[model samples]
Target: MFLGYHILTKFFKNGELSNDSPKESYLYYEKNAIDGDLQGIIQKLDYLKELGIDLIYLGPIFKSKTTHGYDITNYFSISENISSNSEEEAKAIFAKLIENAHKRGIKVIIDLVLNHASKEFDFDSVPKNLSVKTESPRSPQEERWQMSFLFWNLDDEDTREFLIRVGEYWLKNFELDGFRLDHALGLPLNFLEEFSIRMKKIKKDVTILGEVWEDEGDKLKNFNLLKKFKGNDAQRFTSMFDFATYDTIKEVLGKKNGSLLELYNQIVLSNQLNEKEFQLTYFIENHDLPRFIDICQDIETFYITLGLLMALTGNVMLEYGNEIALKGDQTIHNFHESGRVAMKFKEDWSEQEKKTFNYCKNLVDLRKVHSSLSSGSYELINSEENLLIFKKKTTYDEIKVLIYTGEQAYQLDKEYFDLISNNKVLKLKRGIYYLQ
Candidate 1:
């Protein structure tokens, strides 16, 4: 089968990697930046629990040189940069956080950066025969490609086995649930198959999510390629983040000029791959993209996007600040001003902001309570210029979603319960609403 209806995932980065926290900055990779400590994450477990987050896809925590731990220096150690603690203490604290997260019913998964390593990564640790070093290939993600990474030679059996052991080390050592393969596209399909075969043997239900991106025309082609990652007896990835769909959503909601019908059409296109065969993950913002509020430039549009994300049929992920509507100007090339905005604790928000954030809670709860919103089939009941009415229905449940970007009022043919405020209504206006 696939993920349960109640599963809600999140992209978690601890601390404010902004100029506001300057002392923790990396010497070479970033300036005017500071990193959040693992200790600080322990205090936020309750917040994630309250938000109904079932799984958290954490940023890289391996020993690294930057605020975002993608360029790992060591595979077996926690980054001392994240916390002032020694590596041992930092790792202990991380383990404690995972332990606590599991206790609160939240599974934890960190980025698995197997494609490359820091320029500073000690090649001495690698076998001489396996050290077929090469620069990271030219990529659309120029910032990463420009940074000069030491790419792994996956063709070498010793290298693949080394990486496999690295993944296994995390699973066997930490109580970690699984990993988000950093650049699954960079790894060979056979390697992914083998990695899955091994990782699953350690934790049968381990969640291995991949980050695979392809162009619009290649969307279905990418889906078919993802299918190859699985063998007849074992599966490779539980889900993958589809950047094509993410880009379409970003264009429509962010620029506020893209077609609503086109947006819905993208979801319908992606729905073809859903269920037992392939699962896609959707989000409003992540560490890599510009924030919803910043790009949309309108709070109302941001709210509408959030509702659509929750109501859609697929896996759901909330970037660190998305639940409270943190705005950022983060680009693929940089992250100083926006992407690294620090966590806003519950006490940090004003009553109105807190109330608005709780509205996010209600939205997630709606997904969990209604299989129709999560696992059900999606159908467009009606549509117009900037307004669309859709329904998600399964054998046991059904829910209607009304999302409007226009000011026009719409007439309803039947009364239904307002799933958000738990009220009843027979009419609708310019807003996002979920009903049963």
Candidate 2:
């Protein structure tokens, strides 16, 4: 029952500029060096602890052209401009981070973008003259193999083999606790199954979470599409990002259909994944979407939304820059890097933002204290126009009943204490009860 953040630069760096290219270049430089300034990150360790993040998932610190380095250029190297990019220096910083995080009882997971390398990476440095050959429908054999990527020619066995080796190299070298794989659906199924098997041998308890944005059940039915990871295929990678829930929310919101209650049904129904699928990475937004605050509009509702995710069943997650209410524009153009704005901690947070932040902290606290939310079975007890009743029950003693209020506030039994507010018992039978 831990909350997670994708990027932690805020804890280490200072004065992140918001302007375009200069900021991007500055980010590149800061990331390449290890000494940029990590006090900001250090100071926030306790803050994350307060929020109950037993783990934090750093997106990518490897060297790359963009500020948010998803496109990994050097798998073995840290970004040079970042103060600790030198091998020794980077290891030292990583050691300290691991030690500090462990002391706080937090686990660290690094994002592995094994699906593709940045087109900007100096491919010439590699042993082979491997590069994208042509961008057309038909090209020479060598040319096509060089350029084949996630969306295109990776169908080649040699290219897939190279990618698989890259994954294995990281597992053996870095000793990473776990990996949050990027665009897992695009990967060759056989490769994923094999990679997961080899990586697990290195660390028995290592957790692997796949970012499979495809429709699990439907897609898998079409010739096993390397989609669903089940049975022997079950890599240590146990969970998946719940894009299904996010999509449903968008649909519900657009049609202005069913209350928040209906939304909850959609979530629980979607989550009825195969038993092998152990966890669900739940979130309203991430590096790819508009900020949760911007989407919800009402800050209070945002807090309630977070409470639902945290308090409901399964493993939940919060993005790296999500805690401070970081907002970014979502567009098809330059959409990749532009989605992740520098995290603002000192000033941009609104009062409502603080309230939502506190709510997240409290909800995380409740989840850990109440294990039923984590390991228990979830049931959708009731569903109406705007209100849905869901219950989480564990083996022994805990039972959490969730009431999701959509656009309108509904009434619930006054006996239940509002978890957000300390255990102050309420007496009113029904009065605008949204999320409690």
Residue-wise lDDT of candidate 1 within 1-436, one digit each (tens)? 2221111111233452321234445535443233456655676778778888888777787776666677778888877666444666767877898899889888888888988888888666654555444444645653445465777878877888888988999999899988889777778888988999899889988888887754333434654554454333235687777665667777877787678888888788777766574467777666655667878877777778888888777788887777778755444345323555555667677775687688888888878888888888988887888778788899999888887777766767888888876899876776788877
The lDDT of each candidate is 0.71, 0.57
lDDT of 2 by residue, 1-436 (tens): 3466665352234522221134445424332222323334555678677767888777676666555566557666665444343567765566566668878988877777765666566555343634332123332322332442323246655555555565666666654567888867656567777777777778776778777664323322321322254323345366666676766564454334446665766565645652544666677676656666666555455555666666656667787556555555554244333345555553667786676576667667777777766656666667765555566777763554554444444555555655556554443222122223
Stretches of model 1 off by over 4 angstroms after superposition: 1-25, 29-34, 127-146, 214-234, 329-337
Per-structure clash totals for the candidates = 0, 28
For candidate 2, the 10 contiguous residues with the lowest summed lDDT are: 218-227
Report RMSD for candidate 1. Answer: 4.2
Top of the candidates by lDDT: 1
